[model samples]
Target chain A: MKSESRKEEIIRAASILFKEKGYSAVTMRDLAKAMGIKAASLYNHIDSKQEILSTIIIELAEEFTTGMNQIVNSKVDAIKKLENIIDLHIDVTLRNSDGLASLNNDWMHLEEKNLQYFEKMRQEYEENFRAIVKNGVDREEIKPFNIEIMVFSTLSTLRTLYLWYPKQKNIDAEILKHDMISVLLKGMV
Target chain B: MKSESRKEEIIRAASILFKEKGYSAVTMRDLAKAMGIKAASLYNHIDSKQEILSTIIIELAEEFTTGMNQIVNSKVDAIKKLENIIDLHIDVTLRNSDGLASLNNDWMHLEEKNLQYFEKMRQEYEENFRAIVKNGVDREEIKPFNIEIMVFSTLSTLRTLYLWYPKQKNIDAEILKHDMISVLLKGMV
Candidate 1:
């Protein structure tokens, strides 16, 4: 395989391993074995297990940052912005469920520099999310509620969508998105 | 401390370490250091690190199981049953935020017997939760959307409430519970 795809393949294998055994428990040799490659050959592509974890988590975090940045800058109302945000989560999660798992579960194991960077991006993403919810409450587009509760309720459910995605694989994405929005945004009653 | 309170203190200290370093990463020595006690002394109250984890998680899981059983057997309507379910989660999470963290994040690290036990309880809890939702749909109490999505959204948010509870400590528990029930059970719109 070409170098680029070879690197992608290694990262993919590492994401799955990291998801299963977590970042700390999964070793470089284990990642290599999962990839059906020798440890020496694994080093030719990725520098260390830290690099694999950083790649999996930081990349996915940056994707969320990018998506949140878009949602924050959009010329849309609060509810519409949230719908767009849900779509962003669904799209990103469905495409990168394993990587998202690492991002959620193993992010605490990120090395020092990457940990700081991840913290900054995570705080900013949450701030952008809170800002949108605050706007919604101000404009009366959404129900008046505790902004933190609203944001937490929304983001926690959205962030952990990966945990449930594998089980719901057969369900169409669009239908899942609609059901989520309706239940989360609209309520069952 | 008395033996019972000492055990509670040990569990509390272990929970903080486990929350920060995860179950697999946390050692008995680390847990004892956090508690300002000797590792040998720590074993007097807890049998092992695994026992501490099992105490933290299995207790919380059983609390949830007991609460879920009550909800399942209640004579209330689906929405009321869900509200009770939400209250149960809020009450348990508020009281045992750290233990809840271990339950949500570290239960997978449980030893064989505990792992199987946790899985069994978790599956039964989800099944009972689903039965309530299914009954709601059949009785036309809840909106007929996807059952799994509705359950996932509700439970995921409920499960991760501990992650947000500490940050919102200034918020009153009653108000927090009210807002959560409103947003989650009644929908934001």
Candidate 2:
């Protein structure tokens, strides 16, 4: 494998182990074993286990923030923007379930710099939802509710789909996305 | 402190630490320090950290199951029973937020026997909602929808309130409960 591909492979293995066993329980040697490489050879690709966690978390945060930023910047009405946000969230979460799990569950283990980066990305993502909800309310597309609570509740609800959404099922991501957005919008509408 | 009060103090401290830091990050010594006692002193109040986790989890599970059972046995209609279940869920969740957090987030740390007990309580709690939804469908009280999905989604949504529901606010639990139940019922109605 190319160097980049090998690094990605190590990240993938590490993400799964970290999700299952948690960050503290996982070790560099464990990642090496899972990657079918010697423990000493693993140091060539990653500096430490914390480095692996930082890579996975930062990448996932980037994916989420980037997706939301694109949606917010698109030329769409508030309702459509909300729909798109939900779609992007479900898509990212389902596509990167392990990474999402680590983001939610293992984020605390990231180094200080990485933690700040992740938190900033998360706050940016929340701002997207907040803007969408505020715009919708102003347009009378959604019912008047506390903007902060509505935004937090909606995003938190979507974040939790990673825990129970079965990947093997034939459920289309779009359909699930539309259904969730519809129900939440209905409640607010 | 009295022995009973000392035990309560330990559980309370442990729950706060577990919520702030996760199960893997906390140690017996940490709990001891939180309680201002030596590490070995924790043994007098609890057998182990696992024991503390099990106690908190099982207690929450029992509260949920017992509350649901009482609601199930009540003479109210299925729709009202469903509403009551939602209200009780929010009430118990708000009152015992820490315990619920431990149950939802730290359940995997439980030993085999305790895990089984917790699972059984969870299934029983879920069955109450399923029973209500199924009966409502039969009576045409609830709109026709996928029963399994509806049950899981509703329960999962309510169960997650502990993660973010603000306790310091003056929002009335009953009103919040009524609104949540209204939203779910309205969507199906």
Candidate 3:
């Protein structure tokens, strides 16, 4: 494989292993074994196990933050913006199940710089949700409540899809998104 | 401190550390340090870190399961039972916040026997929710939907309170519980 493809392959393997066994339990040798490569050879793709973890979490955070930011900033009504948030959330999480797992469950292993970057992006993403909910409440588009709790509770619950969502099932992502957002919007409104 | 009091203190300290740092990140030495005792002294009270983890998780699981079971078997309306479940859930989570965190986030580190026991209790708790939802649907108290998804999603969302709930500044526990169960019941119905 080309160097780029080989590196991507190593990341994919590491992401799965890290999700399944966690960061501390997974070792460089384990990643190498999973990739059908020697431990020494694995060094060519990644500098260290922490590097792989950092890469996976950074990628996941970028996907979520970018998707949420774009949707929240788009020229749309508050309800539409809320719908887009749900769709974007499900889309990113479903496509990157292992990556999301690694980000949420294994983020403690990130270096300080990487962790700061993630925290910034996460805060930005949260601001988007808060903005939408705040706007909705201001414009009488959504019900009045503790906006902080409402936004955090909705987003936190959505983030946890990684825990129990079955990838093999035939559940249409859009339909599931519709159902979840409908329930949430109904409660909020 | 007496032996029993020392052991309780160790477990309490271990619970806080586990909540903040997670299971794999915490060690026996860390627990000992937190308790202001030597590592060797920890061994006298707890056999291992795993033992502490198991004790904490099982204690929380027992509380949850017992409370849920009582609500499930109660001679009450489905809606009232659902409210009871919500109230008990919030109470257990707040009363044993550290234990709840360990049970939800660190269960994978538990021994096989403990895992089996905890899993059974969790399933039983889930069944209680399922039964309440199903009964509500049959009694025309709830709307028609996939019971499995609805039950799991609602229950799991409630379980995540331990992660982001602020005991100091957030909504009071009783009001939060009332709002959550009201929203859930209204959305379903």
Candidate achieving the largest DockQ = 1
Candidate 2 residue pairs that clash: none
| Cα lDDT listed for each candidate | 0.88, 0.77, 0.78
Off by over 4 Å in 2: A167-170, A187-189, B1-6, B22-33, B36-51, B75-79, B137-140, B167-175, B183-189
Error of 1 at B68 (Å): 1.6
Q: What does fnat come to for each candidate?
A: 0.88, 0.09, 0.13
Over A140-180, each residue of candidate 1 has an lDDT whose tens digit, in order, gives 99888898899889888998888888877567998998989
What is every candidate's C-alpha DockQ against the true complex, given to 2 decimals? Answer: 0.82, 0.29, 0.31
Best by TM-score: 1
Q: Could you tell me which 10 consecutive residues in candidate 3 chain B have the lowest summed lDDT?
A: B180-189
TM-score of 2: 0.85
lDDT digits (tens) for residues B11-87 of candidate 3: 88888999898898998888778877789988888798899999899988888778887887788888788788778
lDDT of 2: 0.77
> How many pairs of residues in model 1 come into backbone collision?
0
Residue-wise C-alpha lDDT for candidate 3, range A130-162, written one tens digit per residue: 888889888877666667656755776678777
